[model samples]
Target: MMVVSTMTSPDTVLDFAHAVALGLSDRPRWLPSRFLYDERGSELFEQICELPEYYLTRAEAAILRRVAPVLRRKTGPVTLVELGSGSSVKTDLLLAAYAEEGASVRYVPVDVSASILRTAAERIEETFPSVNVSGLHGEFEQALPLLEDYGPVMLLFLGSSIGNFNQAESLAFWRRVAAALPRGGWVLLGVDLAKPAAVLEAAYNDAAGVTAAFTRNLFARMNRELGAGLDLAAIGHEARWNPEWQRIEIGARFHRRQTLHVEPLGRRFTIEPGELVMTEISRKYSLPNLTEYLRCFGLATAHTATDDQRRFAVLLLQKGE
Candidate 1:
């Protein structure tokens, strides 16, 4: 009769509350990416992956497919931790490789959804019966300490999740992830590279409008969790790529605009016309940036894989020798 809650921390509620206040407080109210998945958001994202224009999912899968052999060679008792690992399709390759090599892997997936985590844990356990499939339902930033629970971890921040942070934020996050690990630890991250305007733009602003729905679901999530009376119908999704910052920005725009308060955190704000809450930032990286990033964190780059167009890159980092 152990009734364990799926979400591990109270920080998630705080993060969600804070994101809502920031997004709706001032004009041009925006929604945070953390609020995107409320069952509906996760389903929307899964659909997004199937869309013809959203190539990131399929492209990244191909790279992981090619590297299955190299990954299988890694030593056992490996701890595989994924940050923002919802709809983590590429993990199949890793788990299969682990079995073939007689390796027992530990999968630690951290996200901000109880329902998503509950379902994910069930599916992952079914797939990798031998491997210990534990999960932490919290933000990646806060889950650093939890990494200790999965010793000698090979941290994965795949699916262009790193792009969700700004350059400075990315560096700080990297340092935090590196510090959490003992020497000889390894990290594998997927990064979307700067590419042609049309290709990059199309990826985020898909024709089927799945990304838009995914963005708006943030408000729907708040309505459910915080008792905020949000009209999901009044919000729409928009994605913009800033060439200056080399990032993909997603946000929800209030339809007619209005003022709403999230009382749990005790904040009130006005939403403006066509303004964005700035949910996620997908920062495009070049090889130079990736190299400098790992070096600063005391990690040495061991190998890298790139897509056919070199439009995306996956780099593996090892603790300094």
Candidate 2:
């Protein structure tokens, strides 16, 4: 049985406006990275995963293919809950492993996009008819609490999406997940490890410019949904690697001083020439650093698998008894 739950809180629009207002008003303006995943933006991101310079997805998928059976065996029979399960493309490997392991597999994929979640859920049912599938259409923070109701679940945070959250935020999220899990529950975390600066930079600023389009689509989304008069041409995409932070920052730089009235907030803010409004941050981590991070949340790493290039890793973690 495939069940679909929709979460369209009335405050979502106001929530977006308030978040945008606060972020834009701050010194060194920023737009919440979550805002970058509007419909068109999601489609562009799917393209980005296929780019030659974007090796994170491919590397992580390779590792998952090798470790899927192992993870299935370790977790035994449990529901698989995935956050930000966009398309659930690479998830097939694990789903197959679970089914083959004779586990009573049930998949609960949570994502903010209703259409995407529905499509992915349908495809999953078609592919693994024996497995019960459900789609939770809501933000991770909103949908995660429901995991407790599902019982013995193996949580998945794939695609290196956790990189968007800084250390503090990531730890806080892990705490929430940790609280929801029962004893012996497991979490599969995907992370992109720090690499040469050049490799990191190229991944975000790909030569084919799909990544640029992905960033620019945020401006288009604001103009269309928020009624913001943003001139898309006046801003350009930029991706930079901060060696000190071991993170890649993706943002848009204002070409010139410009002011635009935002109908959503009934306000205008002058954007200075050369000013940058950061859109996303992809933080890379080392094994030791990640281990320490997991420990802070009272979780321990159970196993880790990486591709030959060592560019990405998938860590299987469990809460300490």
Candidate 3:
């Protein structure tokens, strides 16, 4: 197992402070969703995945299990690089398929949490000794450039994480990914399809309350890391479907007036009652629309597989000449 640190500790702290300061200062405040995954937050998310209401993990995993062998045959021998790979539970299917083919597999799992990345890398190495596992600890922006060193890699951006970005951000992200891959390289992208608002809402607002805890954990993280001293008790979790955006917006709503002081950034923010601070957005996509969008970045859809309900899709895309 090879683990590389692309970002230093101080750099990570400064980045967090900057994001918090900027976000708190904005009107209709919002924080980058990526910041939500510290160690505890990551664990909470794993629990949320198992909830009956959260069909995304099950749907995407089913698609991967069914398609991994085909993907191995199509891509042949190449590195498997997964961005935002949490726990990497679903990735085992792809690795097993590649291993069965006697292919030399090199996996690069990129993520923000160093501890989780290391643990996942170690576990993969133990589970599949034939495969070489290298963990990249940093944001996608920092880790994508290093892909040039991996050679002929099939990038895996699973979990419909692309939905976190809006139109412009997603395009910019794909452009970077396109630049990172060599010609003929592959991409397996998981996407959650547009569904009924009620289903979408239920997925985020699970009856088990795990999803709510996951949202609240972000504020707890801010308080711990940045010394933000946020009133977690006053903050309530909210998940609502925006039909206009075709997305589920998750936010932290203040039930009463609260003041937060981020010691690291020397910034103070005041929140009024009922003020909702957007934490994340999960945008559901139409297959045709997403495929066309990828084409603009030189990624052509090669194959697509979805769950029986068509609630989710895993698109196998190849970089064009």
For each of the candidates, give the backbone clash count: 7, 0, 0
167-249 in candidate 2: lDDT tens per residue? 77787788887787776778899999999999999999999999999998988877776787888999899999998888999
Per-residue lDDT of candidate 3, residues 1-321 (tens digit): 556565545237778889888887898899989888999888988898899999999999999999998998898888998999989999999999988845668998989977688889989888888889888788887777878888888999999898999777887898898898888989999999999999999999999888888889988888888787877899999999999998999999999898877787788888999999999999999999989889988999999999999999999999997
Worst 10 residues of 2 by lDDT: 7-16
- Global CA lDDT of candidate 1, please? 0.74
Q: CA lDDT of each candidate? A: 0.74, 0.86, 0.88
- Clashing pairs for model 3 are none
> Which residue runs does candidate 1 get wrong by more than 4 Å?
1-8, 11-15, 23-31, 74-77
lDDT of 2 at 173: 87
Q: Which scores higher on TM-score, 1 or 3? A: 3
| Model 2: residues with Cα > 4 Å off, grouped in runs | 8-11, 101-103
The CA lDDT at 136 in model 2 is 84
In angstroms, how far off is 32's CA in candidate 1? 3.4
For residue 13, what is the lDDT in candidate 3? 71
At residue 126, candidate 3 shows an lDDT of: 86
Q: State each model's C-alpha RMSD to the native.
A: 2.7, 1.5, 1.3
lDDT of 1 by residue, 177-238 (tens): 77787788888888888887788788888987888878877676777777677677777777
